[model samples]
Target chain A: AQSVTQLDSHVSVSEGTPVLLRCNYSSSYSPSLFWYVQHPNKGLQLLLKYTSAATLVKGINGFEAEFKKSETSFHLTKPSAHMSDAAEYFCVVSDRAGGSQGNLIFGKGTKLSVKP
Target chain B: EPEVTQTPSHQVTQMGQEVILRCVPISNHLYFYWYRQILGQKVEFLVSFYNNEISEKSEIFDDQFSVERPDGSNFTLKIRSTKLEDSAMYFCASSLWGTSQETQYFGPGTRLLVL
Candidate 1:
């Protein structure tokens, strides 16, 4: 079974410091990975996606994630943290074995807290 | 920029009552999906619709749940009989194609509270 696991349940970072949120996935075949962020009471916003084209994928809001197949990881990182970067982040894996869209397996989200 | 839109930002209803969550996906998109997230839990897939029919659905989407693309533009999810466990945020999403590789844009979810 394909699954996603967010290593951190909560991460606190001081403003202007670096940020890192770890995620790992298990898939039987090639995986399409994604990172999504959700602000309080808001819909999910696509942060970045790795669809086999690139190992390093950059997303909006100065966030980026690297797909490490050997490690089975897609961890999100940012050089500097902003107060606005505080939100719940989810790591998702899509089943691509079939041509049709499959249900997204989501990680237990990690909440980021930025302290000024 | 076109995005998926859902209605009734929050809804409160009694248990056993019927509730319909409405969504209008990106006009040109052909595939639609419904996902739900319980409070403080991961998002779970409910069902997927394409070509005016259900293409796939998860076990959580039991007989109590049904999806319809009644017209060309609107997609709806109806719960026949709501239960207390049904309280959660329901999200509607769409993609240009029904491929796992395609990005599916999500809408502001409808928070359903079954009391």
Candidate 2:
């Protein structure tokens, strides 16, 4: 079965420091991976997505994620953490087997906290 | 930028009562979807619709749940008989097309409470 695993339930970092949120995925075929961010009481915002285009995909708000097929990982990263970057992050994976819009399997989610 | 919009920021209803959640997706979006997030849980996909029909649905979406695009501008999800387990934040989303990395814009969501 296709699944996503977010290694950290919660990650805390100081402002101006690097932020790393780990995610791993398992799929039956080629995969489409995505990262989404949600603020308190708000809907999800797409941070970035990787679809066999580039190994390193950049997203909004100074966030980026690298899709490493060999490792079966798509870890999100930021060079510097900001107070505004505090939010819940979800890693999702979808199968691209036969021109289908496959359902996404999401990880439990990781809450990121940036301390000033 | 155009964004999806959901109505009734909050709705409180008794179990067994019917509830309808409305949404207006981006004008150009062709694929629409419904998802729910129970308190303290991951968001789950309920259903996906396109071309005036349901493209896919999950086990959680049963006969009691239905979706309709009555007109061109509005999409609605109706729960014929609500249950306590139905309480959650319902979100409506839309994407330009069904692709591997297509971004689905989400609505503000409606928080439903079953009492």
Candidate 3:
């Protein structure tokens, strides 16, 4: 079984300050991890993914995450927080059991707030 | 870039009524999926379709729910009877391949409210 756990239910950061959102996972096999952002009344937008490739993955809007296998963690980070970065972030894990039928498992999600 | 699209952005229905949510995946994509998010809850996967058949489905996709790719370009999820618990935002997603390495693009989603 595969599951994702976002450490924070909500996070607030001041504009121009650094931001961090923590996520942890449990999987039996090698997993595919992803971070997706959703704005109010909008669809989910992919931020980045780690598929056994580079541990440090870069995403759109200057956001990035590091995959640490030992820690069982994939934490998203950004050097500077912007107003547009306010949204809900979900950490997801894909099941790798069946070769071609991996369904995504999503976390409860972390709501981010940017304070100017 | 190509993206997945869904129809009926919002729908309100009475209990026991049937409802169908539609989706049009990106051209050339072979895998399609349906997911939903209830108020104050995590998003949950419902089903996945490929080659006009169901590839995988979750426990939430019970007898009341059925999926079909009636035409070449459209995929639909039918709820035989609407229940208050069924009210949620349903999302449609598609990926070029079913591999774990592939990225699944999602649509804006349909907000279904059951009365």
In terms of lDDT, the best-performing candidate is 3
Per-model RMSD to reference: 1.0, 1.3, 1.1
True contacts kept of 1: 0.70
Worst 10 residues of 2 chain B by lDDT: B96-105
- Model 2 stretches astray by more than 4 angstroms: none
| Candidate 2's TM-score | 0.96
Q: Which residue pairs in candidate 1 have backbone atoms (N, alpha carbon, C) closer than 3 angstroms, thus clashing?
A: none
In the order shown, the chain A TM-scores of the predictions are 0.96, 0.96, 0.96
Given candidate 3, what's the lDDT at residue B18? 100
Report, for every candidate in turn, its global Cα lDDT versus the true structure. Answer: 0.92, 0.90, 0.93
Candidate 3 CAPRI category: medium
Clashes of each: 0, 0, 0
**A1-116: candidate 2 lDDT, tens digit per residue:** 88898999999999999999999999888788899998987778889988878899999999999999899999999999999999999998874543577666678899999999
Off-target runs (Cα >4 Å) in candidate 1 are none
Ranking by DockQ: 3, 1, 2
Candidate 2 per-residue lDDT, tens place, B1-115, comes to 7888999989999999999999999998998999998988888889999999999999999999999999998999999999999999999999878665677888989999999
- Which scores better on lDDT, 2 or 3? 3
Residue runs of model 3 more than 4 Å from their true location after superposition:
A97-99
State the fnat of candidate 2 relative to the true structure: 0.52
